[model samples]
Target: MASIVAQVGADRSEAAWLVSTRREFKYDLAGELRIQLYTTKCSCRRAITWRREADIPDWINQGVKVEMETTTIESSEVKTAIARLREKAPFVYGLTNYVAANLSANVLLALGAGPAIGSAPGWAAAFPAGAGAVWINGAALMSSVTPDELDEAAATAHKAGTPWVLDPVAIGAGASEYDAILASLARRLDAVIAVSGEVDYLCDPAGRATAVPGGDAKMPQVTGTGCSLGALSAAFCAVVDPFTAAAAAHVAFATAGERAGERATGTASFAIAFVDELSLL
Candidate 1:
C-alpha cells in the first residue's frame, strides 16, 4: 500500500486542493503553474489511501475517496514571472493600510522588487507613472489617508499603462465611497475578481475562470497576508498581465504557505518560514 499524506478540503467530494502526497507535484490554473498532488497511476487503485492529520484523518465513513491526476513542480509561468521580476527589479508603489504597510513592503522586497510606499502630496500621480506596477489596498483608507489618493493612484496607473493590483479588504470607513471607487476602477479593467479559500477561484475579464489549489489554513491566522498577496501580485503585474499576475501570485503564495506549514511549529514560525519559502522560489 502507498501511504500518502494528503490534506483534503472539508468537502472532499467536491473538487478540492490535494496538498502534499509525499512528493512534489505541480498544477496549472489560469494558464499558470499549479501543483496537483496525491493522484498517480497505479495498477491497484484500492491500494492508495490518503491521510491528513491536520485537517481530516480519513474519509472512509464519508464514502469519499481521493482523485487521480499528478504533475511536477517543474518549469512554469510562475518561475518566468519571478525571473522577470528579479531581472527588472521593478518599482512597485504601494498605498497600504497602517497594519499591512511594513509586511507588504517586506514581501515585495523578498520577491526581488523595489517596494515604494509613498504618501507625499503628488506621490499618487507621480509614483504610478514611473512605477513598473502599483498596489492599492482599500483598507489604507482606514488610516488618515483619504480615498481620493487611492483613486488618483489607480487612475494614473491605468492611464500610464502600469499594471496595478487592488485588494478591497477591510474597507472600514466610508465604505460606500470606497466601494464606488473600487467598482469604477474594476470596470476599467473588466472587473476580474478572485475569491480566496481552500480552492482559489480566479476569474478573468473575459469571463473565464480557473481554480488554484494549495495553501495552509494557518495562513489566515497571520496578519497582513492579504496585503502581502496584493504586493506579490503587484510584483507579478510588473512582469505579466493582470490576469496572469493574479493567478501566478496565488500559486506562488499557496506553494509557500504549504511549505512553511509543513515544518512550522506555530503561527510565528509559519509566518517567517513563509517569507523564506517565497524568497527561495
Candidate 2:
C-alpha cells in the first residue's frame, strides 16, 4: 500500500489516502480527497479491505501550518521598518532626469523624507555631506548630467558610506557610451541598482540579486514610476540596509500600483492614486 498527502491553503487541514490498487485521486478546495478504486473479480470467494489514518501525523500537519504565519511575520517586519523610515525623515539627494525630477521629489516628500535635486559638480559632492542617502537617475528627456558628474556624485556617496540607488533607464536602448558609464559606476560604488521593467530587478553591492514581481499593466503607460521607485528606494535606504531598502521599496510601490489600479478609471487617475497611496503608507 502507498499513501499520499495534500495540503489546502493557509488552513492546517490535510487529506491523506491509502491505495492498494491502481486508482485516481482528486482534491477540492477544502482539502478533501476523492478516490476511485479499481478491482478485478476473482473466481474463488475472497474479501478485500481498506484502511486509512484517522488524522494526519502531527509532524506533517505542523510543517504546513507554519508557512502562512512566517509570511505574516515578514510583512510585519517590513511595516516596522517603514515606520522607522518615517520617524527618521532623512534627507535624500537626487540627480535625476528632468522628466522624473518632480515626481521623485514628491514621492520622497510624501514618504516623510527631504528631497534635494542638483546635478552641478559642486552639488554632487556637497549634497551628500549631511544627507541620509543619494539617488542618481539617468533617464533624461532633453539633457543629462555629464559622465564625470555622475562619477563624482557616486564617489561622494561611496566615501560617506551613504546608501545610493542607481536607476539606469533605457541604458542600453541606444546610449551605449552612457550605459558604459552607468555600468562602471555600478561596479565601483556600493549602491543598489534598481533595474525597472515589467519586473523590477535589484542588485546589491555584493552581486546578490532579488526579483520583485507584481504591478499594474498600466504602470508602464505612466512615466516616472521608475523614478519614483528610485526615490522610494532612497527613502527606505536611509533607515535600512541597501538590499532590504530596495526590496521594500519595490514591494511598497508594486502593492500600491495594484491597489491604485482598482480605483482608477485611466492612467492619469491611477497616477494620482499612486502618489496618494505612497503618502498613506
The candidate that wins on lDDT is 1
TM-score for candidate 2, please give it.
0.62
Candidate 1 deviant stretches above 4 angstroms: 1-75, 170-191, 205-208
TM-score of each: 0.66, 0.62
lDDT for model 1: 0.58
- In terms of lDDT, the poorest run of 10 residues in model 1 is 12-21
Q: lDDT of each prediction vs. the true structure?
A: 0.58, 0.53
Error of 1 at 217 (Å): 1.3
lDDT of 1 by residue, 94-121 (tens): 8877787877787888789999885879
Reference-based lDDT, residue 107, model 1: 81
